[model samples]
Target: MLTTSTRLKLQNICSRLAQGEFVSLQERVYLQKFAERDRSVSTWVSRAQRFQREGTQQGLDGLMADLDLGRRNPDDPEHPEDDLGDWFSNASPWLRRD
Candidate 1:
């Protein structure tokens, strides 16, 4: 959602970085104008990396199966009600004991 001027400035910054240039005075000034946005991008990248690593370790199928099972049927006996601690306490009666 960068403005046209901001996007042009970012493109310039990236081009400079690719050429092994650190922030020059003008680039630094533009960056300061968008410091909060840069910080959020960095934070999101960090979180995404952590999530990717953890998800890979768990396997994609494992993650999907977990998500798929999150929904519970209203008519299912395993549905718990009243006190959460006591909820599903009688699930064995509603589900196959085996």
Candidate 2:
């Protein structure tokens, strides 16, 4: 568990991490937990909402494109089967650095 301040800091760090921004070692320590959590439907809904708000100009297509870009590396261990629901349920968007 993290303190409220720590949680806020972690979210900030994650936002930066998703943008291909730099993060310090301290941020990495706190963010590692995102990799351990279960990715539920609500999680994808929340991410979708965030994308709708922040990337509305591109709409859902943009959202899908971002998802594709996120999973683009041939080295990535997981791939979407039907929709991105599987990947979204298994991984945390906060952990994506691309």
Per-candidate TM equals 0.31, 0.41
Give Cα distance to truth, residue 96, candidate 2, Å. Answer: 37
Candidate 2 structure lDDT:
0.53
For residues 6-98, write the lDDT of model 1, one tens digit per residue.
Answer: 766665664454345565878656655665567643333333333333333357655743444322333457854356445556577765343
Error of 2 at 3 (Å): 3.5
**Candidate 2, which segments miss by more than 4 Å at Cα?**
34-57, 63-75, 78-98
Error (Å) of candidate 2 at residue 46 is: 12
Which residue pairs clash within candidate 2?
Answer: none
Candidate 1 ranges beyond 4 A from true positions: 38-98
> How close is each model in CA RMSD to the real structure?
13.9, 12.8
Clash number for each model: 0, 0
lDDT of 2 by residue, 16-94 (tens): 6555467788756546655356243224333443453454437776766556434333344574435665556677779
lDDT by candidate, in order shown? 0.50, 0.53
Task: Name the weakest run of 10 consecutive residues (lDDT summed) in model 2.
Answer: 38-47
